[model samples]
Each structure stands twice: as C-alpha cells, then as structure tokens.
Target: MKNSDSGARAGALEVREEQDPLLHRLMPSPDPAARFFWMSGADGRLRIEQCDACEYLVHPPSGHCPRCGGDRCTPRPVSGRGTIHSYTVNYQQWFVGQPPYIIVIIDLDEQAGLRLTSNLLDCAPDDVFVGMRVSVRFLARHGVWYPVFVPSQAMESDSA
Candidate 1:
C-alpha cells in the first residue's frame, strides 16, 4: 500500500519478528511498575495501572499517580473493549515486501479519557475507521504481552 500524499513524512515502526524484521530493534525496557501490565497477558488478561487512592486508570504505568500524586498504584483488569480514536496506515517499506499495517489509538471503554496505542489486526486497512469497535488480543514476545486490537465482530467470530 502506498500513501496518496507523497509529501507525508515516512516513519519507522517496530514489527514483531514473527511478522517481519522492519527497521529498529527496541525492546520494552524492564520496568518494575509496569511488570504486571506486561506479564498479565501471560494469562490472557489486559491489566492497567490504577491509582489506589483515586481509582483512576493509568496507562504506561507510572509509580506515582498523576491525579492525587499518590504513590500507591495497583494493576486492574479492564474489559478490553474500545473504539478507534484515530489511526494511520503505514505504507513505507522499511523492509523489502513489507505490507502496510494499521496503527491505532484506542479510547478504552473503562474511562472517559483512558486510551491505549496498539496495532489493529485481522482487518484490512481499508476496513478500519474512526469509532470502530474493537477488542483486545495479546501477542507474547520475550515474555511481554503486547496488546493488539481487532474488530469486535471479528473477535466474536474467532471464538465461535
């Protein structure tokens, strides 16, 4: 797939080895505060950090709460249902014969502003749209569970 606008800036993205070796090789840094969020997928669950004091959901787990500046936070399971806030189809061939893929920003249903950035799978680029309902699926690599989203209907049919 090629971008219609030739003036658009091309960006490099990290693709899984199981998918293809694209450009850079950067692994998730070992973060104690985010260990639960990363490893929770081992059991097929999506967990995010929540401020123990105010009960606000936090992503990219920070040890301290941004709301009340509370130092205590805990990992909580989420519904894993969300809507596409925005997305872009990457068409640059960082590697030869690399197919275009959709990267999306998802507005998680749990909270008003709670969101997550991840890849959209099992759907063609043309099929993706803003406000599309999606569900989470975890991809395990190097003991880290990376959450990827798919169309809600596709997920239901996958389980059927």
Candidate 2:
C-alpha cells in the first residue's frame, strides 16, 4: 500500500514563510521587512505598524504615522479577527510545491486598511471571499506555530 501524507514530499504551508536561500541562508528571509512579519507569526502574535507617540494602530509599517506624521513608531498587536477584504484563489502554481491556495487581505476589525496577507484553511478556496469572517489560529511546525486563519463561528473544544 502507498503511504499517504507522502509522495508529494512537500512540507506544510509554513514553507511560504520559511527560509529563502537567496534572501538569507541563516534567516528565514533576507528581506528585513518580511522577516519581522514572519518572526511575529512564529510567536503567534500579529504585529503591524503603530504610532509610538499616541499608540494608534497603523499599517504598511511606515516610519511616520498618518495620524500625526510623527517619526515615532512602534509595533502593536492586532486582534487577528477580520473579514476577507479581498482574496484570490490560485488556480495555477507560481512555484513548485505550491498547490492552488487562497491569498487573502484580512480587513482587521478595530483597525482599517491594516490588511495582512495570510493563507486560508478550514474552508475551500472557492468558498473564500470578501466579507467572509475568519479567526487566526497557529500552525505548529518544529514547535513554532505560525499565524494562520480559518472560518470560525465560535471556538470549539477538541475532544479528539
């Protein structure tokens, strides 16, 4: 009998945020901007740009705040609950090991335009759409659970 969860030899969705050889061998990604995003995911916390002075939430991780235009900036935690601002189902593979996936821009509640890119699970790709609600959950790999979301109505307790 052929063993399942095999053959594909491909790893989990985390590979999307894992080490990129061309960027930095020792680091997950050579790109500093992206590294922060992944690192926070590894910690199970969603961080976005924030106003250091007034502590207002911001996005795009800019140096200055749109509220005050102040250079004082800091990273802040997000609720991780959001509606599907927009999303697309990848019918074609842009790279090997990547099957058709849903890339979504989560319109976070309690924050505006603070969209973050993430993979959607627990639902079909075609089922993914704007305004669909989702909640963040972590996908564990090598002990670190990265931020991943799925369709959630209410938190369910695991019996199995």
Candidate 3:
C-alpha cells in the first residue's frame, strides 16, 4: 500500500487512522517516562527503553528498570521485526463504521520478553496466526505515530 507521507510501500502494512474512542481515551499523555518513545515515533523510528545499569530492555516504558531498580534508562532503536506471539480478533463495534481488527502481542527479535501489543494491519483478521513473521509500519494520528505490524515479505511469498 502507498504510504500517505512517502508514497512508498509502508513497511509491510497499510496505515490506519486512530478512530477508536477508547484508545484515544487511554492514550497516555507525553511525560518523562514516555516522551522519548513518542518523540522517536514522530521521527519515524521504533524505540524501546533500555536500562543502562542492567541492560534490560523494557517495553511500556517505565521510569525505573523492574529488574535493577535503575532510573538511568534510554531509548534504543530496534529492528522492528518480530513474530506474532498471540492475538485476538475483535469484531465488536467499538467505533462506528469500523471493521473487525486484530490485536497482536508481538515478540520482538531484539530480546526475550521484549514484546509489544499493537494492531495487525493490511490483512484479514482470519489470516493472522501465532508464529507469523511480521514487521512494523508506523501510523500517524494527530501528529503522533504508532507502530502497527503486517505480514513480512517472507510470509507473503510463502502464501503466494
């Protein structure tokens, strides 16, 4: 699919607008712990928090490392490559005129336990499965970009 901004294929997925009211309601305000994450997203990169003291990569960025209690952490860019660890197809109409969507728990290849919960796009919900190789595509809404995943080229070729 053509990316709105670059007119190129947007990673492996198509970007969708953030129309879910609940999602908008729950979106965290930019703060110290997560400001870098948002900034990186705006800059078109996927960054995960890494604890300087223990080298632990933390998702859902926190102020301190859960493993070492270290407050010294920094945002680190990742490969944006991963596999579907788990997922669910939501048919409920949380937003009017929206179709069913897949919510996936992705296991990032960068580190064990380094996972992210995000939407799976550019494919039917029925096509998503555990262990499916996928890559990230950034979607922008209200000037903030969020990462969504789509089937990797290998998977697409395998299906073809």
Q: What is the C-alpha lDDT of each candidate?
A: 0.74, 0.58, 0.72
Q: Against the true structure, what is each candidate's TM-score?
A: 0.83, 0.66, 0.79
- The top-ranked prediction according to TM-score is 1
Per-residue CA lDDT of model 2 for 1-160, tens digit only, reads: 1112221211122333442211111323345544454556564466666787877677666667888778877776566678888887767655655556677788887666667776676567767777988766555444334566666452222111
Q: lDDT by residue for model 3 over 1-160, one digit each (tens)? A: 4333321222433255653323542455867788777556555457889999998999899867999899988888776778999999988886676688788999998898789998877668778889998877766666556777778873344334
Report the lDDT tens digits of candidate 1 across residue range 41-97.
665667889999999888879977888999998898887788999999999877677
The order by descending lDDT is 1, 3, 2
Could you tally the backbone clashes for each prediction?
Answer: 0, 0, 0
Number of the predicted model whose lDDT against the real structure is largest: 1
- The regions of model 2 sitting more than 4 angstroms off are 1-35, 95-98, 139-146, 154-160
RMSD of 2: 9.1
